[model samples]
Target chain A: MGRYFFHTRDGHREIDEVGLDLPDDRTAGLEAVRYGGSLLADDPHILRHDQGLRVECVDDAGKLLYTLLVTSVDAKENLATFATEKD
Target chain B: MFDRDMAPPGMAIFLAKLLSHSLLSTEDQAAIAALPHQTRRLEPNDYILREGDRSDICPVLRSGFAYRQKITEGGGREIVSIKIPGDPLDFQSMYLRTVDHNLQALTAVELTVIMISDFERLVQARPAIARAVMVDILIEASIGREWLLNNGRRNALARLAHLFCELHYRLLDTGSGGLDIHKMPLTQEQLADVLGLTPVHVNRTLKALERTGAIARDGRGIRIADLQSLIGTAEFSDLYLHRDQP
Candidate 1:
């Protein structure tokens, strides 16, 4: 199982419970969209009215991989505690 | 061409010269000179670029101030940096092929837009200009880092003073500091947004600075009573802005 950390508008997370990070090329492709777009430094397509970044993690190369999109980055501390308690 | 009334003539000419020396290659300038285009004038509230819109044009400020800022996830707005005349607006996205931030005019301004394709064509034809544009972007990133320092570490008063001193020197570089009172188009509310502070805090700080003889405020402008003293109070050094080099 591949491991990966995907950063979204909300926060970062580990994917697949496998702890194996994805390839750089794969990561960079995701990063290109997250950090604005491929051509622009910040995504101009993200309007001012849009909410903050909501990120999710993908575990594999499947068309619809098992991914979890976190809701709010402000809740990172709470999420960390929850993850720890679950573990 | 933008409306000429949008910017001071001297400031416009100065900006063009500075950009010509800094961001533009000789060939790029020649290409720009050869282009037959009209200039558009932008008022204080006009946006040069929005945060998430795709536009095929980027403007070079002939005069006045512009800044990049964003509303954070926490409902916070962080002003990334203050732009002076001659600064290349959105040059980063022009090359990196993406738009990262929103740029808005801080005063009535003039802009000369070069179509993105034409600009890229110029870059492809003149690879050296590409390198220069890259260097300019790196400088902007460095500036962004410094602003992080300012916001995270410095208090309200220090941040305000630092901004004034920084602008004073930057405008001086482009020969715009000769005016007795500089046009500081940003309202205290806007300044608070940029400095990551409340409007009340910004107002109190400005008043305190005025009372302490650090800065003199006259309507929309401010005059530094004592440059060295103001710098001391602000704990500011020009080293970070990197204006000394070309």
Candidate 2:
């Protein structure tokens, strides 16, 4: 098991500098994608850059974990995008 | 310490190096590293991959430093970020069809080439390792955000200070130097590209930082004469970095 940190923002104030002890980031990432899935339930494009949604995950030692980022609606890399496309 | 090679093979060594930045289990890391990989050494400014190249394998920096920069249509180069020892310079190319930026060696570099298919399989098999890589990518993304803030909001002097502070922590992560002094291998032009300033502006910024008693220039290195003062000048906080490991 490993500890993970969360940093989320939506064109406003950000949350960071704190970590939660978890099994790992992949587990945490699944939850993030799931949440993004829920947040973007209607449109698979809510997390798009035009929508200005970003979710970042990092490790305790200041190393980047990976991010759920969206540049456009068609971007298939975001958590919400993954969720919408999930089987 | 222990006899390096006598302990294990290439994968084991590679896994040990990754431990500094990841929390993957020995078995998982070893299993992934055991896959096919090619190791090579590169000189400074050597191109690991150029913009618009169609490459499949990813370059994992095993030693030294690297930088990712993009050349504009007008032939101006902009340094995006500096890669530490454990940084996978182009891991994203695993999915993206073509390269968008140029990745090059900033020092005598050591890179390990890992096939994308093999890595994907390894991650699919080892969920734990997958988590670690995700965490690493997230961390890099966060750094990008912080850099954006520096460029958009901070002045030239503060931008330079912030970059120096960020480099200090990154170098410390790589065990490159002591608590205060770091061996800065970057030249003025390279630094300017990262900061979106001219070389002359970078020089002036450095001198300004020195005047504030925040840093002392030591040849190609820098000594943080006053850590708190430097952080204050840069409005720098380690918060965005999310560092907790020693």
What overall lDDT goes with each candidate model?
A: 0.61, 0.70
Candidates 1 onward: DockQ, in order? 0.01, 0.01
Q: Which stretches of candidate 2 lie above 4 Å from their native place?
A: A1-87, B1-22, B244-246
- What would the per-residue lDDT of candidate 1 be over residues B1-246, giving only the tens digit for each residue? 443234344335533544533665444555545543347788886878887677677577777788888877886677777888767686666655556777888888877766677667767777666765766677767777878888777766777888778777767776666223575557776887777764434664676577668788765576787777778878998887677556
TM-score of chain B in each prediction: 0.83, 0.87
Give Cα distance to truth, residue B133, candidate 1, Å: 1.3
Docking class of predicted structure 1: incorrect
Each candidate structure's TM-score, on Cα atoms with residue i matched to residue i, is 0.64, 0.66
lDDT of each residue in A5-52, candidate 2, tens digit only: 555555443455434556877876764554344334423444444545
lDDT of model 2, residue A4? 59
